[model samples]
Target: MSNTASLKKEYAERIVPALKSQFHYSSSMQVPVLKKIVINQGMGIAVADKKLIEIAINEITAITGQKAVATISRKDISNFKLRKKMPIGVMVTLRHEKMYEFLERLVRVALPRIRDFKGIESRFDGRGSYTLGIQEQIIFPEINIDSIT
Candidate 1:
């Protein structure tokens, strides 16, 4: 099957239902197919907690089970004032059909499980791009203090 068709099928048959069932939200959750995922390690985080950047990378890698590299988007970085900490953002491209499947699982199972969770707030960049803030990262099934080395 063509990638596009597979993506459509995946979205329609799998992702849509999962979102509704798991998140209590519709399949039309409205995530655009990402061309790339960028992890904007903002200066705020860079200065406040240098290790946090790595922590985000490690956590994303573990949760997504994908090799996600951390990079600085200068545009994202420049938006911040140097004196204050910047919020670090992770961007992942979802153009591949497989990404839809991963996104489905992540949104449905992994994300909502976070403790003290609230709905995700998204801002569409209007260039087929959106930015979302995940208030905190807790309740991930893989996390266990005892399990950590």
Candidate 2:
């Protein structure tokens, strides 16, 4: 089995029981689990150059191993010169195996490469969700540096 599958199995067998015992939970379903990972990038400058959106799409695809879908503006804004249905951003939603694999790489590899890194903050909303923001896409080892623009 792949590393991610085995890691998931280990979590189910070891972590789940510990969590249940610690939290006084009755069912295993009460344990928190990673649901999905969403990567998003706004293409505001794409308004000036349409090719920027395509480049953003390619970069997102290379990072996530999935095609990104364009996000459209819902309302027209005269001040920003925005129109309805304009391609404003790109995003990829990763779930299941892909999500786990990405999480594994993010935790084990990419995060450590950040200069002067201490540790991730242990903050979360009331809901069982966490969000992390990355400043540069180059941190991930998967992307070929020569190809990036």
Candidate 2, backbone clash total: 0
Q: Please provide the root mean square deviation of candidate 2 (C-alpha atoms, Å).
A: 1.5
Against the correct fold, how does model 1 do in TM-score? 0.49
* Tens digits of per-residue lDDT for model 2, 25-52: 9999988888899999987877777787
The top-ranked prediction according to lDDT is 2
**What local distance difference test score does each model get?**
0.55, 0.86
What residue runs in model 2 are displaced by over 4 Å at the alpha carbon? none
lDDT for model 2, please: 0.86
lDDT of 2 at 33: 88
Per-residue alpha-carbon lDDT of model 1 for 75-113, expressed as tens digits? 434445333223344434444554655555657676778
Best by TM-score: 2
